[model samples]
Structures are given as structure tokens and as C-alpha cells.
Target: MADVLSILIGLMFTCTGCLLLFGSSISADVDDQLTQDFKRFITVMPLREMFPWRITSMNYRTMAGVLQLSSALLLLLTSGVLSTIANMVLMVVMGVAMYSHWAVGDEINKLVPALICFSLLMIRLFLHLRHMPKDKKD
Candidate 1:
């Protein structure tokens, strides 16, 4: 049961990661609509717009997807020791990033999917790293 749930959770992350990347890629076409919808919540222009906003929904979603996809691929395809170890460090960074998104009061509920995806990626990363050496040795 636990293994099945774990796999399902992982699959969920992969699907959402795809959605996030897809959304970011098409954000330019939907920028106006997205901006208009949340102008009150948005502090500045969307990612599609070339502005100096510190953060944008599209930007966050895009990078989050990139990291999540990379993490997943690393977990699924990694066959060596070093790549697995690197995935561990990335997992920690991604975990902090997931928390940072909500720590600043950006509506945790809105980021639930991304949050779950991050968690799943972290789990995969951990599994890959758990048995690997901590450092490279010749």
C-alpha cells in the first residue's frame, strides 16, 4: 500500500510539473488575462513582461517546474553515485524554495500543487542519495 501510494504521489508530481512548464511557456499569450485577474494580488508585471519585479507567478511556476522535472528525471534515470549525491543537495534547495514561497505570505493554498510536487521530488532525491557515498573519492 505504501509503495503504491508513493508511486502515485510521484506520478502526480510529474503531471503537475508538466502543467507548470506548459503554463509558463504559454504565459505570454495569457499574460494579460492573468494579470487582469490578479492585478490586486500581483505586485508587478507577469513573467512575460520585461519588468523589474522581484517575483512573478509565471516565473515561480516556470523555475519550479524546471527543478521539479530535473529532480524527477534524476530519480528515475540516475544509475551512478555522484548524480544521486547531487540530487540530495538539490532536494534540500528545492525544499527551502517550496517553503520560501509560502513563508512570505503568498497564499499557501494557491501553491499546494507545486508544494506537493516539490515534496515528491524531495522524496525521490532522498531515496537516491540514502545509500550513496557522501563525497567523491578516487
Candidate 2:
């Protein structure tokens, strides 16, 4: 069951990653939309604000694409500790995204996707922990 779910999620992320990676370059409409969406967060996100320079929309797209792609690969190609770790990282990323949305006073509906990803990744982590072998304390 978990494997099936993981693969499904992996496929979703893979598609999203590919779209984000290439869509920005392939279509002016996609690039413009991505730029507008990303502009809202890069300046307001807490960690991002600390940087000396502003992050361009293109950079954000590439970074987000890479992160999604790596997470998808981890979920698809590996299980056990690697998947758990990947999910944990994803959870943090999504958490930050949610926070950024909140900080910017965006519509709550805009936050749903990040919240869902964060919740799912947490569940994935918990499931991994539940199945981990107990350490024998001799």
C-alpha cells in the first residue's frame, strides 16, 4: 500500500518538477505566470529576506524544480531511510512555503497545496518510523 502511494506521489512530483523545469523556458505564458507567483514569496519569506540580493523568478523556478525532482527520485527509486529523509526535507520545504504564504497574507486557499504536501510527508515519515526495527538494548 505504501509503495503504491509512494509511486503515485513520485509520479505527480516528477511531472510537476519537469513542468516547472521546462515550462518556464518553453512557454512565455508559463514563464510569466511563474514569475508572478514566485515574486510574491522570494522577498517576503523569512530566510529569503536575509539574503543580500533578491532571488529572481527564474532562479526560484530552477531551485524549486530541482528540489521537487530530487524528492521525486528519492521517493521513486529508494525506500527505507532515504525516502524518509527525502520526505523530511520536503516537509520542511513545504512548511516554509506555507509560512511564506501566511506571512504574505495570501488567500488561505493558496496554502492548501503546501499544507497537504507537508501533511503527507509527515505521514510518510511516521509510517517509516512505525516500521523501523526496534533497537535491542542489551
Output the lDDT of residue 98, model 2: 93
Candidate 1, residues 1-138: lDDT per residue as tens digits?
323433554455466457657754666655455434333333432333565556665666566567656655544454565445535544554555555545546677756754665566566555655655688788
- Candidate 2, 38-120: lDDT as tens digits: 78877675576667887786787688888888998999999888888777767767887898889878899989988987777
Q: Which ten residues in a row are the worst by lDDT in model 1? A: 39-48
Identify the leading candidate in terms of TM-score: 2
TM-score for each candidate, following the candidate numbering: 0.46, 0.85
Cα lDDT for residue 22, candidate 1: 73
